[model samples]
Target: MSSSYQALKPARPDLDSAGLPYSPDYGDIYHAAQGSLAQARHVFLAGNSLPGRWAGRERFVVCETGFGLGGNFLALWQAWRADPSRCRRLHVVSLEAHPFTREGLLAMWRASLAPELQDLAAQLHAQWPDPLPGLHRLEFEGGALTLTLGFGQALELAPRLEARVDAYFFDGFSPARNPEMWSPHLFRRLARMAAPDATLATWCSAGHVRRAMEDAGFLVERKPGLHGKRHMVAGVRRTLRTPGKARLPQAHGGPRTALVIGGGPAGAGMAHALALRGWQVTVVDPMAVRDGGVHQGHTAAACVPLIARDDNPRARLARAGNLRTWARWSALAGDAAPLRCGALQMQRLEGRAGDPRDALAALDFPADWVRWMEQDEASECAGLHLSQGGVYFASGMLVRPPQLLGALLAFPGIRHVQASVAALRHGTDGWQAQDAAGQVLAVGAVLIMTSAVASWPLLQQTGLPADAAPRLATVQATGGAIASWPSGRLAGGPSCVLGAEGYVLPALAGRCVLGSTYEEDKTTWTQTARRLAIAEKMPAMLADAGLATTDGAEDWWGGDWAGWRALVPGRLPVLGPVPQLPDAWVATAFGSRGFSWAALAGDVVAASLEGEPLPLERDLLEAIRP
Candidate 1:
């Protein structure tokens, strides 16, 4: 509609000579429109029949056209929070041609905000993207609710989205004023996003819109409108495949059953990715109880490349990995693996100096989203006191690796076994993954993602050098280190996450985690003693940055943090199809950056296995291949 965009703007709705809202707290736009509460209930809540339709469903997806002021989103969230019968997951896909600024969006949220909604609003404000095209995913409610905001014209984005909607809110402006929104082209795209029998409701009952909907294969109807309106248009998708009846079987290419020898992040992540692409996957790991067996309780890592200001393979992969991982984790919300925090990588000297930051400054990284924080701001933003300069990473967070692995294990087509894999044999048909008891666990395309220690035996016999290990010490001659402790002072810590001598997480499960040591070519149980020693040295580290305080210290939360060897060569993880074996692949060597790169690696592997378009650049994928 011509006026549809205006309706979303903070301007008077009914005024003939429209007056832009002066000093409009973005929140007031909704307040003025039948008041924010009523607008949400009538326009968004009722328009989609949310709470009622979501009852008893495992997952509910709602497609929104306007997303004005996010009032409808807030209302739907409130309803979901209040409803006991709501779906287990809520996915909201919204299209906005012109998005409001983060500051403006927060102001809008404050007008009619509840505590939970306020928290979500704050997150949205924090992660709001620049007005760029493509999808910007925002996760909330521990990943239970996901909002995929497509920042482009509805017609352009509708074709790229992959979702089946349960309901739709056609909240565009009046058809007479905003006819572009009511075009037949958009209606066709809407039809594509809807599942069979998907319901849709709109405040407008204009003849042209009804005709357009009918032409697009919806059974249109006219229902009583809200308030003084005579009628509202509602419709159901008439063109779509019915569930179960139209489901396609997994694509089998010679080898059908696949085997994974490890149940940790690398193996489990590969299993999940392959299963998503319609492969039957079996994961074998002896220590695989539930959740974290050998790899439990480890803090999450962020994907930050060791790139100077300019764009390099490291920077490109890190950027893509960051966005993809954020989206994947958001979709798997409420699964045992939940990403509770974000990460920020800051520079020691603040502004550009001699190294990477200079290259970074050249790319003009999104200043609005990722900006340069001066020393004072960086120190205050990060709870850790700092005296030196550095770039402040605002979205960094320590992740829960066990939780993430658990989520990957739950994929429908993937099966988990607790047997220790003893060997892998490659034959003409495919590969056979066997356990110590010689029981054949699986036969098909195989992916080896076992960690550095486990990988040596498997690769050594295959003529691959012992240097083909997952441990970083092979290349850098250093072992890894980490420690966790209990502390409450970090609860209300700074906004920007900081990393330097050793990274620190405020706390999860009531204790803060700190440490990590780097030793050269050491693969023993020396990590704990080193962590204890570092724990003693932490005060000096924090004191060096002017953050020494007794209140931030406490007993160790998870005992002495141990050291583990990473298989990475130059810190970058190895990914993609394994070069040695024809149908075999590998997802390993993530080092300290496992959390950030794992999900992206999974995606790349899945796409390669399925022969789908690679989501990442080809060169980047080639560099990480085994």
Candidate 2:
């Protein structure tokens, strides 16, 4: 049945006079209302027996129905952070139909939670997106914890999402008050996204809700509810096999091997995907250490598409790249390294109806999942000023590039060696890559998944300016930079990944990061005045997003800010097999779009090496070339 008839609002125990969300002051509510926070802990946390249930797993995911004030998430983060044996990573995904303003969230967090959760609270507030329908992802603590806020009707949003949750927090106000949340369809969708052993806890034990859970293949039961309430409902998910559970074939070539250079998202993703296919993979980098590496050798980046939404080459590649990269990254990092927090791109705050942002919003993708927002809603979500609205990617994320690389490199078939390969030569038997010391680092079929460094004249002989192949499109590099600041005061950051000119991460390690500048290939990573000029323009891009530059902000080294390039004419990255080189392949020209394209690129390369069907068309693959 359609969920269009759900109630817009019902009397909530936590709200005060004039419908302002508030509750009776308790110990945790001294600075704010305690109803929502206390109820969440009792119904969602204690009911699920969290911290104790997720003790042994490598990763754990929890899905909730509401993320109001983020009190529940803060408590969970705090609990997970405090637990010595907590899973290596914790993922929290929540859905909300109407989100609060960033300032309101901060005020509530400050009033309710203890000082310890304040840092995380502030970070959440800082990156909160505009109230556009979709998802927003946030990362914290070196990619150990992730928060995905789904903005839209839970019924409409739940089914569109993918990911396995270890626990469920049925946290919408009340079934009687908010009946839409207690629908059978949502329960079934929840079961679908849950693993066999998934557990759930909810404050309401209403007969209708309990029946729906049971109908949705959950082993529902009743327990004591909070605040002297009569009962609560809890359950475990039932398992159903997906269409294909078959095993994948191993690579046939003798001791199949892939060589990944340049140690960034592309290299890391390539290594990881190949390893999964049982291909022996080795990654070489010039500066990264084999152990105790500084800066972790990677940073988080995005996979956003250009504003225009059409069937052009860039749009198609962006769409394909977005889907492929998102799937692989989600599989590896799940809720840890990144959260599929959808994205929003606005034009001017006061833009007209026919604005670019509005046009993008009209794409026939998923109306309920992503739609245009009015200026007020945009202003509310971003906690800043806004002009015209923009498009929202229901499926988007902000990922820790290094953390993902670390996971990708951790695959069993992959090995890490510290050395720089100066050149490559192919013999009658096979191919050999030589390091500066002239020692043979590798001998087998090699794929040069390195950045532009390998595109230099040294390896230009393999195939060059003459045989660069006919280009379906041309692209140029644009310099970009990301700066960071401690977000100690913000609250309830965006519910989705929000980008305009440059983007801002919700917060990592209590610090928020904003980026970047797209410059013509200048070939320097330095953060120069020109780069900062682009960086400083974020305020205007997010005019409705009320963020001010921090004092003494940490100037992250935006390496060589010169080489930051994005393919011009068409903004898509060049991917797939190298046309000329038989034993070699190249995955380059992924300028600012690397984060969104690399995962998919890695998958496509792995498929190509394994002789599997690629996910893209041949013409599209051959579109981006030298």
Candidate 3:
């Protein structure tokens, strides 16, 4: 399947005299006039025997075909919140071809009689995704509730979803109006995704729909309809036959403790991902501080997505990682959140064949994802003068690494241990991490080495053949430094991040970050060289922004310069398990792309441990496998 997503242009809904939402395209009311919330409880919640069915379960997943006005989701969320015996985690996956705009949803919610649902409706409105044709996962209530909204045609989306649905809310427009949603192909796809004894509830009891369900191995039965409807259908998957093809890998069902040997982006990301899945994760780093020591001194970093002519694995992984990072960080509150002001990749030379804009145009990506801008347009967007125009990423973020790390480690069940792991030992139970003093720092069911190049030495100390993974031998620790200019030094810095050979972030806290010069042999960086390097590119970027550099600007480097080491080889991170060790994984070699790769790589680690669906395709996973 194509990874690109298109934005949906939804037709506005018209309300009847009773204020019931009516769909002009489908020629059907969104819900019964009796009351949408009431209809949801009777036709969906009670039809599938939910609340009671989900009781005491570790996690329960519910799939809905239509999410008109999000009434069903809100009602279900309310029920889960009220039930004392509700499942520990509630995952609601809903598909909608024409999702309502935020204003539309809010207006519908305001017209409702149930005041209890208003608050939940507001929350949903706040978290509503960009109507992009892909699965958008939004988490709420501290990860207790997750809503995976698939914005696209049901036929195209249902088959791509990786979910083990326990119950289904099959509420679509009348089968006569939108037959594709109730087709045999969709039914069979649903069957393939259903878990054993999966139950489905639908208000439409059309004979053809019932027959399709039966043919797909569901035992269907007519039931009392909600409101004044003549009939509704409820069915459960029959276990007599095979449970269809497996949806995805099952969870490991092993111990839920993990030890991550780094406190940088990769380790913090892994800890956060695992913690969200109810794992207790401990991150060890000798330099870690409670107040964001990991990224101290560095005020800002660019979080731009990469573009490639071929859209190779590196580009694909970077794109996926960028999206995941945005979602994960946007859900965070306070200073931990990243600034979402877009970023610009300035064109280096005239008519460059490898320009990102040409590649993006060839790919025909959604405008919201990326768009080409001329120098004039780029200047207008950045609120500055510019030398060249290139591609603009609307979702690019400006993240303070330390703040982000602090936020990732702040999640409950994530402990930050201040110690250096000198060695690792894998035994029958799991893996043990020891400090230089031979003190056991942590023992976990799984071990993730995120210490960058330092991990190779630790692996060698554990008697694990580091050479077993030939790629490990190529890992090199390269050092780099980022210099900054005081905000006053430049005549109003660019409004957003600007990238060419080197990148500059919009001024943050009185300083504009610049110059990330990489050197293989140098562990330290001088202010003079870093300043000159930044100055060389500043004129081109500033000239377009209509800003002129003043005398001595090249020597006026701010105090925000700092050096750090990044592991690299092929510029692709080494992820997944070690070649010969089970339950031991490595997430390193991210190099400068740590922010761009951390979230997705961390999810891969968490998914592998949980035996859950991988966030990446198998081929892409193999490209970075350790």
Q: Name the best candidate (by lDDT).
A: 3
For candidate 3, the C-alpha RMSD (Å) to the true structure equals 4.2
List model 2 lDDT by residue over 386-446, tens digit each.
5545666666677775566667667788777676777767776456667767788766566
On the 0 to 100 scale, the lDDT of residue 198 in model 1 is 82
- How does each model score on TM-score? 0.57, 0.54, 0.84
TM-score of 1: 0.57
Question: Could you tell which candidate, 2 or 3, scores higher by lDDT?
Answer: 3
Angstrom error of the Cα, residue 510, model 2: value is 2.0
Please give the lDDT score at residue 541 for candidate 2. 47
Q: Considering lDDT, where higher is better, how would the candidates rank from best to worst?
A: 3, 2, 1
Q: What ranking of all candidate models by TM-score puts the best one first?
A: 3, 1, 2
Clashes of 1: 46
lDDT per residue (tens digit) for residues 1-626 in model 1: 11211112322222122332222322222223344456557755776666798898756788888776676677787789789998877878888865766665655455545555676466667767655344566667755676778765777666556566778877755655557678888877767656666888787788988998888778888877766668887787777643222311112356556777677666766777677656788777787634776666565443443434435566556766667666666567663544435444544333435654554465444453355556666656665555544554444545666676777787788887777667777777577777668777676665555454565466555565544433322423246666655544444443434465556665566655666666664565465456555455444325342233434344433634344555555666666555445666666666666666777777666644543334454455556655
Best by TM-score: 3
**Residue 1 C-alpha lDDT in model 2:** 12
> In terms of lDDT, which candidate is stronger, 1 or 3?
3
